[model samples]
Target: MLGFMDYVQKCFYRASKWDEDNSYANLNATARALLDFPTPKGLKMNLSSLSSPNFATSYSMASLGVVDGSVSYLYSSRPLDNALNSGDVQLKDAVSGYRDLREIMKPDDPRDWEIWKGGVRVDRRDTLLYGRMYLPASTLEALYLRRLAPTRQLKISAVSNSRLPNGGTILALLQQDNGKWSTEYLYSTDVALIGMRGLYNFGFDPRKALPRSTTATTTALDPRKIAGRFSAGAEVYYGILNKSGGMSTGFRYTTLPSNVGSPLTVTLTVNPLMGHFQASYAVKAGEGAVFCSRYDFNIYSYESDLVLGCELWRRKQGDDTAAAADASAAAASGMSAGNIDQTWQPETTSFSREGARDDVTGVLKARITQNYNIGLLWEGRYKQLLFSLGSNIDLKRREQPFRTVGIEIQYNS
Candidate 1:
């Protein structure tokens, strides 16, 4: 019994102030909370270090369309650093033998997450289909077929449009536009990453945090606040998102503000190595100071010095990523974009993403993957922003929760 209890304790263990130095330990607060159980009073469980930083590699080799590589490094940080996860000395050295490792592990890919993405998403009791229209139009220095009416732009976003679902769902990025160069999410949701994310995305499971409890479902979200995925509905989230880390925030008030539903839901999304496959994450706050991550995709035009882009950013939800190709056509005219930069695009074409996940104790395991995607281009006059659409495809366990193909238009200087 002691051994069993010890194992349980280790599985759901929380970190102390000292261990907080580690990023992996810092963010696992949620994982630990969902796993925390009880012991005799005044007792502490000393566990052997489960420090095998999770390693992920693709079984296939790089092919014509599919970029092949391996991700053997384990990232263990909360706050992002210069390189993140593998940037750690131990992880970098560990992966050195696999020369192609760098090609497979990328932080900026829509599906790739060097250490971790934003947060987890929830599941609808029924078939949930979320559709949104994200339009970014700025007549400043924008371009499009409506160059005659240069101030026109619109967009739409959907989540789980088609499915016969029944599996542990992990929602990463679903779709994206383009940034050329940058290190932010498809939709930036860092605006309100604290409570909003803490309550809904991961669900408010108080049981795991309770010293005496081992299960997670019995706990509840804040009764007065109208929290949890089942409780809230969609609205609009906004803020500024750029390189060097920026802020993004918004709010959502639910249709039915309060209910006693399942309070624990963690979607274990896998990152596709192809770098273009997109996934979205719902944000959640950590134990200490609250930090946020947003998912996004934008479609914008740059005509002259005027730049307009349609965007969808879920402060804790996710964004749009659609840029216009013709944005550079009018470089000599007043509609020409002098200097608009795209610094968020990923470095390579491959990646391998995986992580250990535990939801309500029954399903506590790993979500490993190696995926690839080709660019989605529709340059004719798809919508606005000079259309060329693409997506990230995650190859993981039982769930394939996303598919993206869109039209775009752009007007450049």
Candidate 2:
């Protein structure tokens, strides 16, 4: 983790990765630790974990996870949407074989939660103050964990492709606990893009959101129900640099029984500048089958980007059993089975952009009991290729004619 930039630098110097220094790589390494915290309540409080002096110098953070049967709660130093959507805890059943974080907590406790575990940051030799308080109930709607807005913030530097020596940005986010609605507010002082987004979830069926349907009989069903039929949202944006901004709107609709099928998601986004659409689908091959496929398409400039991927999990159940056993053993020993796993996973992903560039990646991973894993990832882009080899302890080493290595040690609690 600490050596991502070093690895990229090595690659660039050797002419193996790209001709130019990848801005994305530098930005990625610059903020990796500060951007995401452990999900389902795993804390990363060590400044050493984040090499950035701005973040690590004097800040503290913690994560707490409370699981009482099927009702689980997470209090973390992160956003609720981030925790619910991509975080470790899974509260939604598979739909067409896809488990996305758009789902919330257990059906019984359906609200999404966010806590502003405040921290101290040193920016440009100045200490700026900011934090948030959660609002348990909102009069604006019949929502739990709603309107966390009495939030306040001060001038903070914004990270962007274009640097601003004397500029800063402020951000605000709002959401309903049940994933029914959400919004974001942003303003930039350094002449970056300022924008606002508002969204509403229209047709998610609570009965379907549950692990099991509540119908009294197999033949009984609700006539008005449809699996998260569609969601609509709008964005109003202005660019300080361009001196012009316009409004844009988008919506996503899905079809497939809320339970299982090759669910197809089609999205359309339109603005004064341009319009594009994306379609994605995912499905389980069949009961007891270990193969699954997920695909995505984005249309732009009359060209499109397509991603095709599949996962073959022959030992999925075996890994689950091993995890359960590890959990039991950890519980008996008064330790957490936080990051322990012994499982094998195999997968492949292929990407084609604008029908000109193609990349294919294959991964093989094996988890050794007591929180260890050995994995290899091979990727070929056009004629350029690279391979990585690693173990849980040693992590990944990128190899080419010249090479760079990064060591990442994940902590589980």
Candidate 3:
């Protein structure tokens, strides 16, 4: 017979679906990614190497008529935390043990394992450190992140530059997440700024027992099966040096989809002190394509702006190509391909399994602003190198339509 604690752990695991843990600050991440894709202003190159499972270093150079360069170093206690190179191979053996449990358990049956492997815990142990130094200017920047406990995290970042008012700036953040809610408290040396932000998820509670009703089971067993997630959050900040304070409230609604499909995200935010309001929407318009729009308004100034953007991905043809085409057809017909019958798998496992075949060959992104400024970017891979070429154009300017043009290339080994 399973122990009481074991039973509880099993129940929790069965009822929960693995999802990306994002903080309140990222409430509009999806829309931002689509609308605000960064474009290089000049020539930029990045070269990186993974010396070991937990260590990596990289060099970056940029030329905008004048040349400048930087070197960066990164260290991680866990291989999974290192983004220079995915640690999928290292994780394969670790996840194999859980396959047995998955096979034995029902869709709604809960199970437990080590926190690192997939179990829920109040504390986790992972640390990452990164540092970069710029040439000529001799500017330095560093970042630190540590998971103090399952529910707590500490993040610190600092920058040093001669042109800065204090020759540098440092910001420290303390974060807490308990599945249903997330909060962060931060302090910055610049202006002696202090702030707090929090987000609360509605309609779901992981700590509580799972509901036995069929309708509830559908939602509790898999996040993708749920209608959607609604979240409310707020942030308040004060600057000691400036002796000023401000607050903003926001609401977000998002859907959780399977690996084969893209999710939808919508966000609304208002800053009462500034009399500013903003709304954003992002969604998958079709297979390999995403659409985003944002609106900004200021009541006090009676000013408003609107922006529209879209991204299209090009992938190599393969066996799954037909399936993806079918998915696109389904989407066009007002159906979701993710609703198709498929075995439920952990998020990590799904990512690792589909990592290779899902590689995108190229991407095209374009956005237009209310001011008649248009930006276009094309990113693709060449051999082992990745590159982005972009340009900005001002339609209102007859003398010079092109505002900026640049190219960026990156390689990792």
For lDDT, the strongest prediction is 3
Query: Candidate 2 residues 1-413, lDDT tens each?
Result: 21222221222222211111111112112111111111122322211112221111112233334211111121212221211111121111100123221221112221222223355332121121222211221111110122222121122322322233443243333322223554555565545678776665564443353334565642233322344456677878788897988786766554433334554444455554654543344344442221222222334466444433332223333555666676588456643222211110000001111121111122222222121222222211112212223222223333321222222222111
Residue 303's lDDT within candidate 1 is 16
Each prediction's Cα lDDT score?
A: 0.20, 0.30, 0.67
**Per-candidate RMSD vs. true structure?**
28.0, 18.5, 9.8
Clashing pairs in 2: 85-101
- Higher-lDDT candidate among 2 and 3? 3
Name the weakest run of 10 consecutive residues (lDDT summed) in model 1.
141-150
- lDDT by residue for model 1 (1-413), tens: 11211221221111100111111111223322222211111111211222332211111122223333211111222211222122111221111011111100111232322234366533211111111111121111111110001111121222221231321122222111121111112242333221112112224332222233434432332322334332111112233433233222222211121223422222222112212211122222211111112222222321111111111211211111111222244233423222211111111211112221111101111111223222221112212112122232343423763343332222211
Model 1 misplaced regions, further than 4 Å: 1-62, 75-249, 254-413
Quote the positional error of residue 304 for candidate 2 in Å: 3.3
Best TM-score among the predictions, by candidate number: 3
For 18-82, candidate 3 gives per-residue lDDT tens digits of 12234688777666666777778899887776677567788889999889998888776666322
